[model samples]
Target: MSLAALINQLADEDTSALKTLSLVIDWVRPRPQETIASTLTRMEQLEAALTESLDVHLAVSSRLQSWLDNAQFFQLLSGLGLYSRRGFFKEISERLYERVNPAPADRNNVKDVLFLVFNRKGDDAWIHEVPDEALLKLLGTLWHFSPPALERTRIRVCTQILNAIEMLSIWVAAEELEPNILRLNPRVVDRESAFVALQRELAAFVQSYVRGLQDEDEIHLDHDHALVLIEQCRDEIARLQRRSVTAGSTMALTHLLERLSQTLTRIEHLLDILDPADKEKRTRRSIELFKTLVQASAERHGVRTLWRDNLRLMSRSVAENASDHGEHYIAGSRREYLAMLASGAGGGLIIAFMALIKIQILQLGLGKGVETLWVSLNYGLGFMLIHMLHCTVATKQPAMTAASIAEKVEQGEHGRANARKLAELLVRVGRTQFVAILGNVAVALTVAFAIGWCYTRLEGVPLISTNRYDYMLAGIHPWQSLALMYAAIAGVWLFVSGLVAGYFDNRAAYLDLAGRLRQHPLLRRLLPLTLREKFASYVDEHYGALISNFVFGVLLGVTGYIGYLSGLPIDIRHVAFSSADVGYAMSVFIPGVEAFAMFTGFALLIGGVNLVVSFTLALNVALRARGTRISSFPKLIRAWFQVVRENPLALLYPPADPRPEPLPDNHPHPEAAEAGQPPSDVTDSSPSTEGNR
Candidate 1:
């Protein structure tokens, strides 16, 4: 029952080493709320008990040595350290398969013993907490008590290490030959790559080591050249990773590079274990290798971790595209701020027309499904037209701007100056968003009211019936309706649309859609070369925005229908549309000033919810994708207050001062002028001019 009793029983009986080791591990394992010191103390007690007497030490040591002699260490030493032999997709599938249907255990295999010993979920959590010193001490105690492994066992381990190195080297070389990798470094294909040279060197080293072993000669194996090649391979992988950021990357390319990196690291660890020059160093390395094995074995069936690991790079790629699109939503100057207002007003005019169409569609006694389809078409086509005309939607700005803000946050150093810069950027974004919302609501309401007045004059009747007007009024009542909740739903759609835009942008780059379009056979036959090229260029620039706008419109239109089918209260209430509805309601019947104020107040509240929810979600995702955090929220808040205190109206409008002019292309850099030479770096600073060049 106790550890001392268990050791005594093992000494008396010829128990299997697996059962004995499992019992020992169970006794020494840390309990819940137990500290590492406690676990170390328990390990010390077990060591004392194991070395209590010569007879007991010999008996237990003999059993452990026997287990070592018979058990296959090759798979544990080689396979556990390396990834699955299968490709990335197959490896993922295999992990999932193993989770569902685990293979039968083999007592002869060390892997089975590992699985049995560290079988519980979250085993890696505590195992990782244990310091290297504690692990090394535990390993040292075990090695001291147990007799030395048989000479055959030692040779077999070395052979397995060599085999793993050879296998990993070949895999690395093959991965380097992948098309995505070659695209980044084409020279790798033309010559003997580091991976290939490593493979060749490994083969020679293995042959020499094997020959020396067979002849019983004191052989000195020089792994310097092989290690140098491994470093070179790693440098190439790093270079490819850096290049992928600019050239763009796909899941497959990311997975290949990840696998190559892991394989190369595993080879280095294996080589360390195989070093015979220093037993003490080898023992320490072996403990580290054992810890890696334990952690890997514990997480072997973790599907979520695998998915997260695989998606991290791709998510970053998507976020990068979103951030690029987001920069336009942030206005850095007065001209851009005014341009955003005009854009928002243009979008609002279309939205007012769209609202009238939605009302007409609902008035038709068409079936629910047909009505929903027509409404969706109106919203989708209207939004697409707005995008085509370079108009801005107020609600859509937050999702885009949040990503841009996150990019700035990621670029800033963690200090007071950086926080102040971010605060200034935030103020700019706030003013831009405020003007856009003001434009959208002001223009949509006016247009809708004018349209309603014209219809009433022409037909001698209000555009909306009294009952319908009352219903629209009640729908937007902040206290009496679910207007804010519905607005939040619309906010969620805005966030999703941002991601949709990013995904399409990433897909276009990955697939070279622009190039494909330019080369299309149909385009070649139907249009002139210049026209075809322009069309392709336009698509390349606006593909994501076009798709995302349509999708967002559909999402907004279909929410009420989904709620109707599901018998739920799900729906959306966008600020621009709500303002248009109120305008139509006002045209039918002029409510009291207090009632008008209430309608306007609720519309503004709805807009606030939409902005908050969308920006929060988008900022969270962007930060995670960039692997960064806002340096200090308190500092940022203080900086914001300081800016607001200096000028309360800064959040509504840009400064009166004009934007500073850029230096002419001929203007010399200060350093260059002092040196009396033309500046080599002088080039167009404008984005359009740079792109054209």
Candidate 2:
């Protein structure tokens, strides 16, 4: 049927209004090509015809009054029990949908219903002039003729129409009399824009409140005034929602509601915090609450929010990579502990040789630019080779293993039992670290001492200049030098390297590095199938480790030269190299046993600082990234005491018979296995590109 005929039948027929309305919607909904202007014209004509055909003003009021006389409809709508109402709404909605079944895909029944109800904007002028009885009847009619109670789209439209009339009714009652001319109110536009601005002010209020609560500062604001303002803003938003029937209006309404809810919740929390309590307990309570809020903000507003899902991928990938490195730090039995010591000794031997090569590189007397490049290459290539050799640098273990520890902590909920497990892990890490340091230093000093003696015998002079030897001794003097601070700085670099490694590893897995490499045009055209596959697999597994090592080398290589150029005391202090330097100094410069003893003690102090700073920073970052909190520092200390008390030997020596331990969680998340642990891989990713000294 034609839309005009459908509308005429709906308005003129004495049949059920609901049935007539449904027939109109089913007839006129699908006109996707219709323009806004044409639609408005058609709707105006229908409204005029409908008004002439049916005495809408008088009949609608009486019909609405009669229908609502018993108040049964209100009971059905607002007070109906949940279970009964669901079925009631379902029956009404199904009857409507069945009439409109086999509807065209592009047909929008909700828009049609809205058009029929609000055929002309001028028709709403009657709402302001009508008496209370007529007004109430008009609202009831709008509700009764509402299309399909369960159709959310249509319901939303109907809500706006009713809400608009309700608002106009309120406005009319407030003004009492009306003028002939319709003039725009500048205040209305200003008020609406101000309402939007108030949303921003409300957000700022939340932030300021949080900050004030944290700092124990006074946040003086009249709560009643704020509440009144929020209500007004809400009212303005409702007005806007009704005036517009577009997706933009819907989104704005939704956003404003969310902000209002969040702001209200925050204000309540702030009030709770500001309430007077015990003096001793108040600060602690506030601090704990602030920490929780900060963590939530970090998760929501920080970098994690931009790539929340990706970080989960990274955490899993890094945890997997760390698990491989972690296994190397753990000794299965006494035999394995001894084997780790041997491996550390081998690592120390290589470092001593690297130190000797560095001295030769310095002696070449190249320009600063060439020297820097050569030194960078010397350290970068040396470290990468050391990693390939499967040896362990004592300081490097912390940066690599921290992720594994964090992952395990994340798997379990916070409790004394979990703390005990962490304590046990710490004990193993401690013993392993001590043994590795012992092996590295003992071999480094011996090998460097041997090299110095051999160079003296071959060249018939001191292997290193006396000035260079003296400078090394001065660098280690704790009080007289910046050695400890430099060690801490190196520790920061170690932490950064760990993050860089994790980031690259995340990229490899996420980007499907191996598959991409194999499918590359150059590789596909030039390489043998087996070789290309092998190369791709190698890069997929080891790219992060390899890149991290090289970058770390470059950072260490240029630091001293950069320090000289910039007139800063910035430098790195690695324990193995420091030990090697001390050994060389002992052979070439130290004249007495007492002097040698003092320098050796100083060197060990530097090593201790390096290990402590790097481990602490790396562990803190990894734990935070995994969202794992240790609960309390005192609890951790207590757990450590308990672990040591139960098995004193576990701290000093490896267990005689090691058994397989169960994974932390019953349904552990599976992670793909990555590459092995590599030594000297802890380097700062950012470094100056300037030449070395």
Candidate 3:
């Protein structure tokens, strides 16, 4: 039937007909088959007819005004053609609560009437196929025009309005939209629509929204997929920009271009962060971004969003454990070099003793479990003492030092000249490592040889049998045994120790462990204030390193047993300990100079593998943890070569000038001491050895 006929037939007293017409308006659903022009034409006609019909009814009867007074009538009118005048409709919302305050029952009565008008009909009401055009017109006329009290209306009213808006969102053109109009388009949908302009706008809005989506919920996107999607957006923006120049810049075109530029900038920023080739730059940005995301979680979830935010708390606490570890890497002068050397020497002395203990333990003829325990105790207690005494373990430097360097790099230390800076840093590290290793191996070999010589002199027999001495010598030879593979395994253990140190450090800081320990009731009651405070402070500073060192000892102790269980020949060969083993072999067994030289040479080579493989792995992890990446190996190698050619001694000796390296401006770590300070220690002893106790 014609819209005019429907409007003309509606009478003030014919409430059923008026209600039916309201239902007809609410039920209008848009269909894809209809053209835009035809839809708009129908809408314009229906609105004019409905408005005129409502005006005539208002003029003819007091009943129309009474119905307008009823809240239910106003709600139904909102679904029909009630308040087309935007200004007056908006005022109804402002004064609605005031009106409802005086007689809330009037509002409830209105709701009751609405319930009967719509709920009683149910799905049968939806069967009436109201024209999409008419529904669109009615929705546009009444949208957001409801009285404030109607805000609490039932879901049926909300659903009708939402359906209409969703349908309208599909038809509305971004170019034609005014900011004043309420548009519910989410701006997050994939837009491959025919409307090129709207597609760009939608993509831009979605991208902007995505950057802040933790406020909504988490979203994880594939790195490659995000890049491809961004590339498509870039192309579309360029195409739109070119067209805007030819079409002449309208206000809409200018706004669209601005959004496109902003979106392109955001896409580029994300791309820079994700690029694998740009490791240094990527890591710095990623660290900052991760930190920001973590901060936002607090803001969005309000500090302890779920379960008092234990994860973040624990990470921060664990990070604090690295403070002491970090300080072990920074060297500024000759004094620091000697300190590091002394620390290494001290560690080597203990490692030599540990090797002697291991050999004695192996001769006990105990089961593997008992053997593992004794060996662990021998290594763990020895290393714990080394750490307490502040001695050095050469391979452990990479993991802790990486975090320190990453912090420095993150403090605006990157750009075109980053390669040179990294080269300088690497040189310092190389020299420090060289001296430490020298101190360790030199002392350990000397100590082991002296111990073996003294023992043989006292007992009038060799410390190890001739057969076992040959086996130790042959084990160091790469082709005769798995020395290289075992060295690599040691390297892996070194890397793990670094990670363990970092994790515990973070945990300490996050949990405020020192303060918590100080606050313990027993400690407060039993200890003096000074002692309690000191104890807590020590734990806060040294707990992670202590735990990591002990764990590392256990790991080293179990390697052979694990490999044996798995029917493998896995073992570990560390440089300092191996050199000491070779020294013992030379003292007890080897008679020929050629044989002694080969064993010594092979032991040194095994040590080299252990240091290189472990340090390299540790460096990689540290970079990743800090969201930093090393430049390609070729680039780093070239840089190293350039530094070497300029000054060959830099990696072996301290420079004459010896400027103190500055701490990073934003360094959060608070490690207790510097390189020249008392050195920390861990054992590098292998798990097995020679003769009976």
Top of the candidates by lDDT = 1
Q: Give the alpha carbon lDDT tens digit for every residue of 1-693 in model 2.
A: 665566545545373433454453343232455443443444445445455645543444343333333222111111111111123235345536644662432112322223343343332332223234332332334344423332433334323322332332233222212110011123543343434444444444545544544455666342344455545655644454333211111222223333333443343333333334444343444444333332332232123232443344334435445544556677657897898888788888988888888877877889877888888887778777777787767777787667667766766554325777777888888888888888888898889988998778789999888778778777878899888888887777766666666657656755668989999999999999999999999888877777777777787788878987899888888778888888887777546888777777777787788788878877776675555666667977899999899889888787678566764332222241123221232222323211110
Where's the lowest-lDDT run of ten residues in candidate 3?
A: 684-693
Per model, state how many residue pairs clash.
0, 2, 23
Give the poorly placed runs of model 2, Cα more than 4 Å off: 1-325, 414-417, 519-527, 590-594, 658-693
**Candidate 3 Cα deviation (angstroms), residue 244:** 48
Q: Write model 3 residue lDDT over 1-693, tens digit each, in one string.
A: 466555554443454423543534333322346544554555566556556666534432333333433334222212221111223224345436434553333422443343333332222222224344344345444332345423333223323322332222233334224321112122324544223443344344344434433233544233454445456655654555443322222323333434444434433444455453567776555444333332332222122232222332232223323433565676646778878889889888888888888878887889998998899887777777788889977767776766556554544235645666667777887788878888888888889989999999999999987777877777788998999999899888887887687776655654568989999999999999999999999998887788778877888889988987899999888887788888887778546888767776787787788778766765555454334465465776787789888989777877676566774433222352333222133122312211100
lDDT of model 3 at position 372: 87
lDDT computed for candidate 1: 0.80
Give me the runs in candidate 1 sitting further than 4 Å from their true place: 9-12, 33-37, 70-101, 145-159, 182-188, 191-249, 268-289, 307-317, 398-432, 453-460, 591-594, 620-693
Rank candidates by TM-score, best first.
Answer: 1, 2, 3
Q: What is the TM-score of each predicted model, taking all chains together? A: 0.82, 0.52, 0.51
- Candidate 1 C-alpha lDDT tens digits along 356-436: 999988888899899999998898889999999999889888767887888788778544348878899999988888999
